[model samples]
Target: MKACDVCGKKSIIQKSGAHRYGGGWAMRATKKRKVWEPNLHSVKVTHDGVRKTMRLCTKCLRRVKAEMAKKVAKKVEKPAKGLHFCFNKSIQFF
Candidate 1:
């Protein structure tokens, strides 16, 4: 059984339904034809010191994106500490 890399949980259920994607050739059908496909999304997953890719459900991907964004925002908000020493040195040197 395949397992989720982030959550480490095996898929609780088999995913089923129609799937549509961009950036590729598309095939459409009228009432004369019907196509049933599975819902899947591309994900940039990092694991085991390497970045590998796999298909994921939309819900999981969205949550991962939000979490990554939050981490980045927190990192940007915290300021570096070296400026205090630089400022004091400049003031005394002048």
Candidate 2:
């Protein structure tokens, strides 16, 4: 019943069987059905000056984290306009 709120990812059924090995030969047993669920986490998010909680999968969570990091990087102050710094030389303004 758990799923990602962002992407709507859900669980799936996987068919699997047991294998027996003997004398370099392999034998298969009766196939079984298994439920494969996505890795989901409950996260708290803030949007439009409001706080909310959401469920997100691992992939979506990673993407959100990367986007937040980019926002933080953009907020950081950079060198003044027309000013440049060189690794081998001193600072210069153009």
Measured by TM-score, the strongest candidate is: 2
lDDT by residue (tens digit), candidate 2, 10-79: 9999887756563333345667899999999999999899999999999999999999999999999876
Residues forming the 10-long window of minimal summed lDDT in candidate 1: 22-31
lDDT of each: 0.59, 0.88
Q: For candidate 1, lDDT tens digit of each residue in 1-94?
A: 5555455445444333333672243343222333333445668788688998976666677788899999899888664544444644662222
Q: Which stretches of candidate 2 lie over 4 Å from their true place?
A: 17-31, 80-94
Clashing pairs in 2: none
Point out the worst 10-residue segment of candidate 2 by lDDT: 18-27
Top candidate (lDDT): 2
lDDT of 1: 0.59
Q: Candidate 2 at 82: error in angstroms?
A: 12
